[model samples]
Target: MKKKNVISVVVTVVAVIVAVYTLFPFYLVLMNSFKNANDIVASPVSFTGVNVTQWITNLSNVINNSNFNFWYAFGTSLAITVISLILLALFGSMAAWVICRNKTKWSTAIYMTFIASMIIPFQVVMLPLISTFRDVGEFIGVSMLQSIPGIVFAYCGFGGAMTVFILTGFIKNIPYELEEAANIDGCSPEGIFFRVIFPLLKPVITTVTILNGMWIWNDYLLPSLMLGQNGRVKTLPVAVQAFVGSYVKQWDLILSAALLAIVPMIIIFLFAQKQIMHGMVEGAIK
Candidate 1:
């Protein structure tokens, strides 16, 4: 009993430490966002003037400085996220269903191919992909390399593998009995998939959507490479990066932009946190 009590105490201490480590950065950002440039630069360690009025003043300056261009960047990021999620969910779920249902040698081979592709680092393919896109654009007389849809396509290709993998595990657990019943009820395979199987996978779908949505929304590297240095087509992350560069280490504006970038993510997590938790539990159980 004494040993168990000691172990529990140690575990609780470790958990608290880890929680604080994770939260401290966000706390710092929140506090810094409300502070003036000199205050942040001179005494970042000191927690000062994080009151309502300060927050409102800092946030107002950030918004005013944005000149509504923030909304455009946000909208672009959202569109890419939504489009990528839809493509991944639809194509990934279909691919997973085929792999789970059809246990043929070809299907196994195809699944393995996707898994293999997942292991190939984006860095390894980055240059080659760029060259290919450039060549394709030149040939077709349509530039895809620095376009919105181009980035969306890149996301789908890179993201589909893991989404398919997770959805497959969930689908495999979904008892073949359900599919069998649907077949007997005068339902075609496509009908059964669309009507029944897809609906049942809602929790897992929500999980994937949230996970991938966060990633795509916050992604800077891909957009940087594919979208070029054009301010007009920048995503939120790209915009924030450019904002910092333009300000040239001005803490007030930089922290304000950082805060702007963070608020949406915080809101998203807060609202969909329950769904995320439920999906995780359901996925783990099944």
Candidate 2:
């Protein structure tokens, strides 16, 4: 009994230390965002001279600055994320359902191909990706670079592998018996999927949505390359970089912009954390 109590205390102490280590950077950013550049440089670790008015000033300056276009960037990011996630969920679920139900060499091969594709680093394909987008844009007479649709397409492709991977695992655990019974009741494959399987996928779908949503929201490199530095289209991260450059790296404004960029994602995770964890565990176990 004494040994178990000692182990418990040690584990608790380690967990607390790890938690503080993980959150310390975020704490620093929150603390210094409310201070001027000079004050931040003078004492970054201490909030001794921070003021509420400074927080308002810093945030206002970031949001109101024409270069940053905080509201416009926010709208653009929201639209892209929403559109991409919707498409990913629909397509990924459909693909996973088909793959799960079909017991064929082709389906197995295709699933393996997706799994293999996940291992390929983005850097390896990024140049070709850009070139292909450019070429395709010219051939199609619709822009595929520096456009919302183009970015959405890119995200769908990149996010598809993992989405299908997770959903496929979860769907496998769903008994084939339900689908068989639904078919006997005169339901088409589409009906079985939409009315039956898809409804039951809520937990895992929530998991994939949160996972992909966070990635698409905070992604910087893909957006940076797809939407040029000075392009009219900008996500929050890209816009923050542009804003920082215009301000000549003024830390207060930069940190404020960083804080603003993360607020939406933080809110989303806070609300959905339970669902995310549940879905992940269910998918893994089944």
Candidate 3:
């Protein structure tokens, strides 16, 4: 009993330490956001100069600045993220179902291809991706380099592999008997998938949406590359960079913008975190 108690206490203490370490950066950002540049420069970690008026002033500066049009950026980010998640969830589940149901060498090869692509980092293909998109956009007579649809399309492609991977694992464990029964009932393949299979994917779909939402919302590199830093269309992450200058860095405005950008994702995670865990564990186990 004593040995178990000693180990449990040690584990709890370690977990608490890790939690604090991970959250310390966020704490600093939040704390410093409520202080002026002088107070932040004097002692960033200190709580002495924290005030609500400074907080409002900083946030107002970020919001009202022409460079950081918060509302427009927020809308662009929301549209791209929401549209991308919907498409990924729909197409990913459909592909996973088809792959899981088929028992051919081709299906296995395609699954392996997706898994292999996951190992390749985005940096490896980013430049190529840009040129390809530019050429294709010109060929097709549509602007793919600096558009919302272009970014959403890129997200779907980048996010597709992992979405299919997770859903495939979970689908593999779903009893084929359910699908077989639907087939015997004279349902079409499309009907079987949409009416039967897709409904059962809610929990896992929510998981991928949240996962992809956080990534797409917080992503800076892809958006920065596709949508130029000073582009008319900008996501929150891209717009936040406006506070930073070549020589003069606005720490107060930067942190305030960072705070605004993260608040939505934090609210979402707090609410759907349970679903995320449940879906992940179930997908892995089954």
Candidate 4:
């Protein structure tokens, strides 16, 4: 009993240490966002100069700043994230249902292919992806770079693998008799999927959506490459980068902007956190 208590204490200490380490950056940002530039520079970690009025000023400056254009970028990010999540959830569910139901060698190979792609780093293909998008855009007479549709398409493609992977697992545990019953009711394949299988996917779909929305909303590197850093089209993450100039950086406004960018995601995760956990556990077990 004494040894078990000692082990529990050690584990608790380690977990506390890791949690603090992980959240320290957010704490710093939240703390310093309420301070002015001078206060931030002097004592970023200190709470001495923090106040609601200064936080209002900082947030005001960030929101109204022409360079950041918070509202415009907010709209862009919202549109892209929403559109991408919808497409990914819909098509990913469809693909997963098909793969799970077929149970053939081809389906197995295809599922393995998606699983393998998940392990590959995005850095390896980013450059090639950009050029390919450019060429394909020109060939097809539709601009694929620095545009909403283009980014949405890219997000769907990149996000598809993990989405399909998770959804596929959940679909496997769904009884095949359900699909067969729908078919016997004179339902087409499309009808069976939409009317029957799709509705059952709500839990896992929520998981995939929340997961993908977080990534697409916060992604900087891909958006920066696809949409030029200073281009007219930009996501919130790209817009936030405008605060850092070549010679000087505004830590106060930068943190303020960072705070604004993350608040939505924070609220979402907090509200849906239970669903997120439940869906993931269900997917893994099923």
Which candidate comes out best when scored by TM-score?
2
Task: Report backbone clashes per prediction.
Answer: 0, 0, 0, 0
Estimate TM-scores for all models: 0.84, 0.90, 0.88, 0.87
lDDT of 3 by residue, 1-286 (tens): 9999999999999999999999999999899999998889889888978999999999898888888889899999999999999999999999999999998999999999999998899999999999999999999999998999999889989999999998998788889999889999999999999999999988788778767777898899999999989988999988887546521566888888889888887887788788766755654453
lDDT tens string, model 4, 87-204? Answer: 9999999999889888899999999999999888999999999999999999999999989999999999999999999998888889989888888889999999999999998888
Q: How are the candidates ranked when ordered by lDDT, highest leading?
A: 2, 4, 3, 1
Residue-level lDDT tens digits of model 2 in 1-286: 9999999999999999999999998898899998998998898898777999999999999899888989999999999999999999999999999999999999999999998998899999999999999999999999999999999999999999999999998899999999999999999999999999999998788888877887798899999999988899999989988887888758898888889988887787688788766765654554
**lDDT accuracy of residue 110 in candidate 1:** 83
Compared with the true structure, all predictions reach lDDT values of 0.82, 0.91, 0.88, 0.89
State in Å the error of residue 255, model 2: 1.1
Cα displacement (angstroms), candidate 1, residue 162, comes to: 0.8
- Candidate 1 at residue 189, lDDT? 92
* Tens digit per residue, CA lDDT, model 1, 1-286: 9999999999999999999999998878888887887788888868765566766777677666653257777888888889989999998899899998999999899888887887898889888888888888899898878778888888998898878878998898899998899899999999999998999988789878866776788888888778765645878888777777667877777777787888888897798888867765554454
Best by lDDT: 2
Clashing residue pairs in candidate 3 are: none
Task: Supply candidate 3's per-residue lDDT for 177.
Answer: 94
